[model samples]
Target: MPMIRLPSVLLLLTLGCAPAASPPTAASPPTAAPVQAPSAAADGLDAEQQAWVDSTLASLTLRQKAGQVVFGWTGGEYVAADSPEMDRLLEMVERDGIGGLVISMGLPHSYAAKLNALQRRAPVPLLVTTDMENGPGMRLAGGYALPSLLPLGGGTSFPPVMALGAIGSDSLAYQVGRVIGREARAVGVHLTFGPVLDVNSNPLNPIINVRSFGENAGEVARLASAMSRGIRSAGLLSAGKHFPGHGDTEADTHIGFAAIRADRARLDSVELVPFRAAVRAGMDGMMVAHISMTGLEGPEAAPASLSPAITRDLLRRDLGFGGLVFTDAMNMGAVIRRYGQREPLLLAMEAGADVLLQPIDPREAVDAVVAAVQAGRVTPERLDGSVRRILAAKARAGLHRRRTTELDSVEAVVGARPHGELAQAVAERSITLVRDEAGQVPLAPGRRVLSITYAQPSDIMAGRAFDRELAAGGWTVASARVDDRTPADEYARLRALADSADVVVASAYVMPREHSGTVGARGGFPALVQSLATAGRPVVAVSFGSPYLVEAFPAVPAYLLAWGGAEVSQRAAARALAGEAAIGGRLPVSLPPRHPLGTGLTRPVRTAPGHP
Candidate 1:
């Protein structure tokens, strides 16, 4: 792989260490500072906190203690108090004594209200968490009151972590974490399963691509640790995830098993660097991925989340991570396909997972663990240790004092104007002009441009922001949307349309997804992008997702990378195209052979009308 072959080149691209010759000298985002000693959960517990944890753990019956380690899932949308779903969830809390919940997508007010209700019913305060990798805004896309007319409130949506990787701003990353924490806390969320610690060394990795900080382990370590600190500072627990590293694997654990074959030396140097940093940084939690590393376990590709050698020995005993250990979602294919339903939960406990997130069935999950403990398959001491950690984390988050969220405060704290501004800033700063050979940027305001958004049909938000920004500048845009399914005749039609326009702006969105299985542009997207390039019009290709897109259509004369498919990134790309924001971002990952790491061209902000 290019990542392994290009070690020397990777060192120079460390955050904040780009050479003087690189463009945009206007103070690149500050590099990560030296990490401090483990300070948060890793500090163990103060006497009062330990007492509370001990008392809480002691009070729980075997079933309740087992429930404390089993976290169920809830959709953040409003469920009437009398609804069956609410009844089921309430049963999980009241009857089974489940520890926490992993909330999926929903509105902010509804989410807060539902969580508040759950907290009120629980014997112990539930440790609410979500996969808010970007922020709560990522999952909370408020429903429209009238389809598209009246907009409901949602949380702040920042650009992806890869955008942070490209900008390399430790301060901005911290603020991203702060916004995530603040908004998440407002909605009664205590932990964000994020600041993905995966090194993103493998460009082919389908699930961890843009979710990871960057390819370089040290840079990933620095930025992720900084983000974790920011999360804790906002009074929310942060989990740096996919422990033992999910960066280098090609398969998505959501669908199938993936194995990392690196030897111990390579694993330590490349994969485990950020995790060690997280351990030292005192992150509140760590999630073990379902992927296996043969290098760590030897010969057999045992799933790390179910292997004691990886989670207990390597993570707990060897790494000394004192915080909570969460297993990756139990319902994923990596576990279920191999171990079936009930056995995985029992095995995860034995593997040393403190929290089993999103089990196939919470009732069965609780029973299985309770049965395992009774059978001595999992030790009673091991279960209690996990319960103590969970209770301590809840106490640390001040849940012991106040467990419920205020309904009125949800709208005020989430999706605040300042949070949106920060998102815009990160998006603007992260737009990297990798190749502008045609010099088509700073798109002339009066030109009749053909703007085409190439994305999955389901990516409804792909180019709306970009087109809106362009239209605001009074530019004539003959817009079209294309996906992998666009027929050849449609491409020919677009090619014909391209010839009539002065410049063709082709924006492609391709990112890591759970079941997508491949990072490359799917189906005919490469052909579609290539077709536009052959149109002879100076086609400016921009990637709103993976920066590696340039590798697929390397001949596209002009290229810009927004690093993600967020609306903020789309608007940022449009602004860069209009010269509204200075283009300074360098490549966080290499495209190989031609554009190595840190290859970016600078364009000064447009001064006056008609000026380049």
Candidate 2:
């Protein structure tokens, strides 16, 4: 793995401005070393790398320099190297000298081949990146799909950094990060838009639900820093994202502008804590969100991604973040709906963003920036600074030496069994027993268990795995699937089936989706589940997605927070219910007066009523 080499002058500038490093806490794992503050000689650029950066910047025209900061996107699926789309994209790369490409989705080898082809024809080495929030499997098929971070925080069958917080293991967080980094690099990804630092302070936040580590700033900061350290240790750049904070907002920026009304003091104590920790952890990049901070940027503030007050004055000046600043997808409705396509590109640059990600039209965006530089609206020096950062990042990734990923190694390295086992171990460790007032859990094996799953109609029945795991334990399990649109009559039939069961296990899987406003159970599904809990039979409510599902169904007698809808999480829930595994995870976020943060009930595994 190649390392990023910083110029001594740049290091000095950052060192002079950066905040003092925070000392590691007593609870911090031994691996949680205090991040060293920047020094002039620390990772200083090698003579050769510096010479290359100088030569590359000196040779590029203003148009080419502008292109160097614009990143293009590839579809989530495979596009043949010879396809028209590929041809058009390649032409832009060659003609316009685009600096980077973000792969939205693809198979491993096919994606690697496309990336190699693009690198071959590019004027400058491209910094290839992707949103590997759930690991490379988030975008690449056939890779291990780690459970979402929310479940990991609450307790999932998959290992998530949030689980590290629950387990209070900084070393485990580092391990998860290292595994993610290794698997990502194996699949040809250079940088991951991950370890989402959002605090998820608002339960109504449309998009950032379980993706966050937890709601507490200190836990989020500690775990996120550990993951970022692991990523850098694996030789991959980590981008701590949605700067200032997007955790407290109600709207999804992908659809429209989301605003955080926090004043500076509240922002410093809550939202900014993780970002400050990220900087101390030596994070490589900071992705600015499309959110508006009305407190800092005024009531009519520009989107944070396009506001100099938020991006430059706040993140750069106030926080002293010297990393590459990337704007979240410029084509998102939040920015495009308000500003013209070309204007946001220039505005983000003027706001001190080093990368303009996912622009609507790469060529036009490049042209707009070039025109601004030429007309003196954006200065040449400003353009050079961004270009320098891009070039330095590419060099650090070893793109300057070897731009192509090894296609043959993808299958052997990605989704390996050891990695999957690690994910499972984490998930099992994070399973939280929220409430068991009637002692209905560790259910006897002979009980007739009715498993009702709530999910979107189009989504895979996420609860089937739970049923299978329960059946394997010698329990009589009947299963039914219900979505938001399921008719009342269908729920009535499910209730009738529940009457025949000794116990009812209601599994709720509600995750965030674009344009969706809430992460709670939709429609009459909550009512149906509540009816089962209130029925004569004992009901064990299992949350497979949101940890806060209890708020909607307070009547549930026994509740277990499994934290995610993944297969591992489902299996863990089943195992916990069958006395096959202990419930050890604590909540990473506060559920208010009912179940506060760090609340979890531990249980020892006992023989089932009918088993030895």
Candidate 3:
């Protein structure tokens, strides 16, 4: 395999963006000032108050003041629920006086409990935040999965709201946001750090998948604005993240430092549209990414997270966001490389970020920020500005007071009767069966069914729930996942089965990185679809990773978009296999004309008889 390399000019452009040189004037460092205790104002917050912010900052001790500006932890990911790390985390706030806490994937429920507990121990409130992009379920098991934006980005008619632009409805976006809201509020989370506004014009891009709204900048802007509607509708903070842009870059932030090299003009034309639209749509925060955009910032400086240009001039001054600004992850490679093992919380705060997403050491970081404020390196006004935004979101999420969900009945809620019914309804509605050139739907009972598959048996969990769906469904189901040694022969095994079975259903979940990759699946998938079709099986190609599989194997007479390879998708696949309804959904994104988008056939959603 060839090594992936970015273009030279692009690399140069990314490395060069820096804050223009300001002529240096000699100034002496300020000495210590008496650290006063911060107090909440007697007057209550207005319908939209900045006054509380004023008093909160004024009352904080220098150390507490710094702690208020620097967020603790990189994300929602927790270190063993209420572990020593948790105690240390509380100490950073209650004792050392840090600003906020970001709960990551592993520790959401723990975050909620600890934060609610800390409401007693700490003088100030903790701005608990999470990247509940797909809702808390994306972190914990059994949460309602809002369709990740990818599959929704592909189709016809609705055609991914990005395709619609002004033709798109903010109401529709709000409806989606409402879904996000409903899920977020149920989980006791105050903020959802997402609605990625990156423009994914490049199909081969690695990081962005359905997470992006669309390819067209205008469309992406419109759809992203819709997500803002979704965020607010849920009464949670919706953050426009990975600023200035992450989609244009190909590297994954989980592993390495990535960079975007676009010029100011280029950024405005392509990347800035959705971000501006999101701000206009009332998004509450901006999460700066670790990815470097070279010339866009000060020379020899780090990512926009710590760049004065990207945060202050562009976000606050020019765009007038006035909202909270955040860094993607203080623990990521980009920040880690510069900081080494030590925490650099003060730099992030001074760079204009109101909240730090995740950090390696909250105690040290909070102390550094405290020392910065005491030393007058960071201003009180700037610190308060960030705190106010966080408080507003907390108020909206009803986090300050006790808001309880029946956790005892949490089991009943997950895949609950009502939710499952809703899922089945949406499933039938979303089924987009494209390319039935030979009319594979509505198969008769006697037609033998051959199922060929691909999976990790990992992302889906240690045990498989899919087998249960296949076993009880009254169809002879067979599956094989692609791996280094077995994939080639598995194709033959599938073909032999396809030859015997009256209809052949082939599913693919090749890899995690497929959604925006140049080539999808392994090298052999197209061949597998081809060979199966050659066997004269009515090769029904089901895309579990993406709905765009038709582009790769248009020769297969039958194709179905399962969206993702989750339990919901599996159930939908079985229903589609049984021809439960027509594939009514049109393709949301474009593909080869041969495959055509918006290809599913399904019955219209039925209204409840008694309710009607």
Candidate 4:
């Protein structure tokens, strides 16, 4: 099988030698032995690569240089060669001379074909990127076949990063990254915005909940650094995100301004720990958040993406991160609502972001930067510095050598069996039994189970996998689905239905939504759970999205934390419920009051026949 060969710097990164931000805890995995030749150069490139970057910077005109920092977006859907969409994209490349393209979602083969088409027309090779925080399947839709197993489809979508934190294995974290990287690169994605470095210190954080590795700073650092190495090893650039941290904040940046209110000393100890480790690990890039840094500046300061104090002084100077720095999507409400259109673009450049990601208007963004440079608001030197880094990243991704992806090999590489198996394993390992006061878990195989799923009306995929897995495990499952829109009168009837079952299993799918700032068990779902708890049947409450959902129905006798709403997590939760898989995950974050960090109950897998 052919593979994308990485450079020497990437090979060193694969050896897993990033220094520890702090000493390892008993629960934390030991850090790898430090390698001496860290790839801490302005760009982790060879002499030949550096020459290409230098020459590319020298050749570009001011407009092109300004456009080089402006990254545009596109859905991975098929675009005809001569269509208006393709024409607009080509103009964005030729006229605007945009440096990168962010692929949001699409089918596997079509996604690669679109990129190949664009790459062929691009004046300079475009740095194709995506938010494959979990895996490419998170965006791209479609399935692929594997021998004897259900056809593993789309890209291999793993459980969220919190799953890794629960499993607490750096090696597993690396494997997850490697799988995500390979599948992303297979689809022509050069960079993955991943290994969410946010520490997830605040459980109520609506945006960054399960996306974070865990709350502990040192553990988060160790696991994230390991994963970043795996990403680089697969020849895809990895970008640690929401720096210095978005986990400690309450507001969702996708909606409005969110602030990290930590002091500098606390920031160093918690929020910045993983980022520092990312820097030492030679991570290819860092994505600044649309978050305010109250620690560095006063009560009222611009977001870190536009704050020179946070981006240039803190991340670049103090942490010494020389790689590409990307602003969180410029179209996000935090940026658009605060600074409107043009000002944020100019401010982000002044703040030293190499790439203004997914701007609302690419032409306007380029024009704004060009005008700023002309008026001396943004210096030519500053513009050139960013352009140089952008070019260096493209070179590092081997785009300078081969711009187009092999469309024929897309399916063979993406959604392959190994990737799917790894994702399932991560999910299985991450099913943490936080509480089992009633000892109702692993409900004997023949028991009558009333499996009710609570999700938003839009989450149609929530409980299908869970209920199917439970039924396949030899249990008789009477399933009911409740969304926020489910009428209040329906719950009394649902409670009556729950009373007849030997065991009632409630699954909560409260995940983060982009524009919606709040997250929890919505509407009458919590009341339904409370009624279920009081019912004679032993109720097992499993959270497949936010671990903090337990706060809503604290009195449920049995509780399991399966992390996210991904199908893998639902299936794992079902397996854990049926004793098919062992429950080994520990809490990466505290459940608060009753459950502190690291609280979990272990259970051995049932080896008896007929259990499957």
Q: CA lDDT, every prediction?
A: 0.79, 0.75, 0.55, 0.80
In model 3, which regions exceed 4 Å deviation? 1-51, 74-85, 105-114, 143-173, 294-302, 338-347, 373-377, 395-424, 442-445, 461-474, 484-491, 510-520, 523-527, 534-536, 547-555, 592-612
Tens digits of lDDT, candidate 3, 281-308 = 6667788877777756534647777777
Off by over 4 Å in 4: 1-42, 142-152, 609-612
Ranking by TM-score: 1, 4, 2, 3
Per-residue lDDT over 486-565 for candidate 1, one digit per residue giving the tens place of the 0 to 100 score:
78888778877877888888888887766878877755657766767765568888888887777787778898888877
lDDT of 4: 0.80
Clashes of 1: 1
For model 2, residues 26-103, the per-residue Cα lDDT tens digits are: 121222212211122213456767788889999998889999999988753456768898888887799878899887
Once model 2 is optimally superposed onto the true structure by TM-score, how far is the C-alpha of residue 41 displaced, in angstroms? 9.7
**1 or 3, greater by lDDT:** 1
Task: Give per-candidate clash totals.
Answer: 1, 8, 53, 3
Best candidate, lDDT-wise? 4
What is the lDDT for 315 in model 4? Answer: 93
Query: Which residue pairs in model 4 clash with each other?
Result: 142-154, 143-153, 544-564
